[model samples]
Target: MAQIAFILLCHKDPEAIISQARQLTAAGDYMAIHFDARANPADFQRIQDALNDNPNVTFAKKRIKCGWGEWSLVQASLNAVEAALDAFPRATHFYMLSGDCMAIKSAEYAHALLDGEDVDYIESFDFFESDWIKTGFKEERLIYRHYLNERKHKKLFYASFRLQERLGLKRDIPSDIQVMIGSQWWCLRRRTVEWVMDFCRERKDVMRFFRSTWIPDETFFQTIVRHVVPDTEICTSTLTFLMFTDYGMPVTFYNDHYDLLLSQDFLFARKISPEATELKQRLGELYAAKGIEFQISNEGRSLFRFLTSRGRNGVRFAPRFWEAESSLGRERELLIVVAKKWHVAKRLASKIQEVTNIQAIEYLFDEASCPMPDLGGIQTQMGKRARHRRALMRMLYEYYDTDRMVICMDPKNMEMFQDFFTDRSITRLLEVESVFTDDYLAGHAIRVGLAGENTPSQSMERLLPTIRADVLGESDRIRDAGFERYYRISELRDAQDNAFALSQFLTIPQDEALQIAQTNHLFDD
Candidate 1:
């Protein structure tokens, strides 16, 4: 099994770093921490002194006044790497981490997974084709020299950048090497690490070029790994789960995110907020515990990526219908509550799951919550609404980690999306006929052009069978006349009926389904 060594690049929160270092190295694994030069001297010394008793912990040789998108970060990392090589001779892998990061999974589990694998977990991609360097100089960022600190001296940096552009000054990359870029977090094997280190040291000319390249920390190792390690040995992905906003800012985890963070498949989660003391403590206890088994999953990662894609605007994605639905829904089963008025469906939406254990969710077509489409395009408005509705169902499908989901939708929406509800392979429809007397006025206001007075849709004594339709088979023959493919709220009045519907559609046992439904108070309300 490979022994994991951690390289932590931190600028603040010494106490947090000390805590993480101790937990990570508790198993005799090693850690090399690089503190920024500008950090409080007492903070840096505190971390060093705290880890001093541990033979496996070492600090970088020198501190660097690091700046965003600069080479100092890479140099500080190199110093730590050198210290680690000297201090922990037995470590077989080196993982790059940040100050706010914590172990979501135990170090032992990571070792077990990497036991028989010789692959390097580093995300590398063709610089130009990858299109990952968002909102910055494109390919020119690599080939152009950058000496100004963008974060520290914004005006000077921009002035220099503009001057360079005006003068058309560009540096030349060695033709033999292919430029690549990726996330800075990487877990490279001992051999790969040494090879990269040697290549970095020997390639003075290329090293000099990287020193002047913007954000060298992100591209330097990526380019080196691609050239030194064969493609077969490299896994183009990182071991850390670092979520980012649509604008590419890291998502800071809070105390409430404790369960969600650990449920991920990644060994580590980057950029944990220092203020999330409870989350850190929980993670520490989990990490310090021995022999805990965790199932590896890609869906957890995919699900989170799908979840975080949401922001102030809407669920971010290309303006395409198929991409919208599939990205949100994946292959999960659906339970849509189809009604004529929004309020009726939404009110019963909450109770459907309570009374039946069906995973009923709120409106899929949330007109109020979603933003209006850009001006002057009716098609855009219609298309955006449809995509939002379908995507919501798809997202719920994955979020609950089940194949099937139930949602409250409007009949107008169902008619608008006949293509979606008609898909027999993935959908299960449900209808709500009755509303609580107190809510009667609520649904009445959201009226459809029905009976002249348009009185309350239903009364306390009224119960209705599910809507029906004639389904046809081959030769245009009606296999079953007046046959509908949906369940009704009245039919699921008891546990037995609820269990049957949930069990049949969810593929779980009727009894177990009833237990889940009962636990959620599917009928108690």
Candidate 2:
């Protein structure tokens, strides 16, 4: 029988963890939970009380006070793995999951996927050769030793690191074992798990070295598995799904994003904030129902491959020397150009660029290509357009090397703006009345091969009413919400407030912008 022992390392939100544990073990799969010693004792007791009755759940006895970028986290995980082996002797597989992660699939699905495979399923690659680390000391993580926890003692730790760099200090990564790095999420066969424990007991020298290395939990099991297991039995991917920003911060999931996450291929998702009550409860309910089968498709897996690959800006964007004040979006200003017609959106973007200090993109979501700043260009995959557009939006907000950007998107595909409401300081919405014009017709002419005034193909005709509704209804709501970026071409043209509209983001003065728009008939559609 293929049984899985889900090892969850939990710290906070006892209620959320309790829900997750019960839901995951509802079908007789085992769970070994490790609560961080730093978490509230009452909360831990509450979890124990809730789960004490279940024969399927066991708590790790060796509670470590886990801190970020420290050896304690790995120690905590090791303790949980030991507890799982002791309690669920029949469990043939072990899964390592974060405290905040939710199991999106039934326990039976995991057993099915790993039915007969003797594999160590984790991501592992050469540290020096790989460009996966966006903002971190790559080879320096291994070549140097660190004592101070980077998160806990930021200033002292960096000072120590700098002192070492000045001294040309180098530490030997234990003999002949290739330096490897990867995500901490992993699942392993019982035999491989046992082998890892045995190695930990025998290899005290290597273990000592890792204790002094920064964030070794990320590499400890991943690196050890590559050396211990045969290449044929190793898969460089994880069962869990999580995405990070360019500054190496994991994106937290909220209520709105749960649906998007479930559509992906991963078995589990992480960084579900304790504040996300709705998202947590909904996932619990969905998984708890009987006969629910969440299938992992080839298409979702393909998308995952593309995202994790080097082509997604690699570490090429983040130089090891430059430090981040914050993630890119927080400091940057964004103006969204929303119009139903592509040509109209493009013209507005051009006008905005000419007057303002924003790097304006012609078409964000179009049939042909959306030229990304650094990423040569992107071909819009209309099939999975929603997820595709969101992913691109996230990337641009995090990594696009500019303080400002103007994205031109049609109302039908107005994807990026709302998703990043919190990430940006200046989020502007520019809605055009979307009056049909000969220029719009001329652009469509190339596509539909229509004669004069062909009233936009049947699909566009059907979509127009919905677009009009959204545009007409959203203006008052946006204005009431105190969003100054709420710009409309009709308002600017009718009231001659083009200068006032351009004032906030102006590279040129308001009078000059007004004159330019008037001279070029820029506001006339």
**1-525 per-residue lDDT for model 2 (tens digits):** 688899999898888788888887886688999999998999999999999999999999889999888889899999999999999999988999877898766555656778856677899988778886767687777777888888889999999989999999988888968767888999999999998899899999889988888888888888888878888999899988887654557867888655455655677888787788888888776654556554332233232333344233212333222122223355666677666566656776776667554678766565446655553233335444434454455466556557677887655432234444544356777666545444544444334322123222442343345434444444444445454557665523543565566554344576766754454544444
Best by TM-score: 1
Candidate 1 CA-lDDT value: 0.67
lDDT of 2: 0.70
Show how many residue pairs clash in every candidate, following the order shown.
12, 0
Candidate 2: residue 66 Cα off by (Å)? 1.0
The window of 10 residues in a row where model 2 has the poorest summed lDDT is 318-327
Over 1-525, each residue of candidate 1 has an lDDT whose tens digit, in order, gives: 678889989988887888888888887678998999988999988887888998888888878888888999899988899888888889999999998888888767878868867899988999878978778677767766789898788899888878888898877788888889999999998898899889987999889888998888889899999999999999998989887766778888888766556556688888788888889998987766788865332233433453453232222334455632443333556666655445555555554465456666566364545333233333145455564545544444555656756665654332333445444436666544333343443333223211112222341112111111100111012111222455544323665765566555446666766664444433322
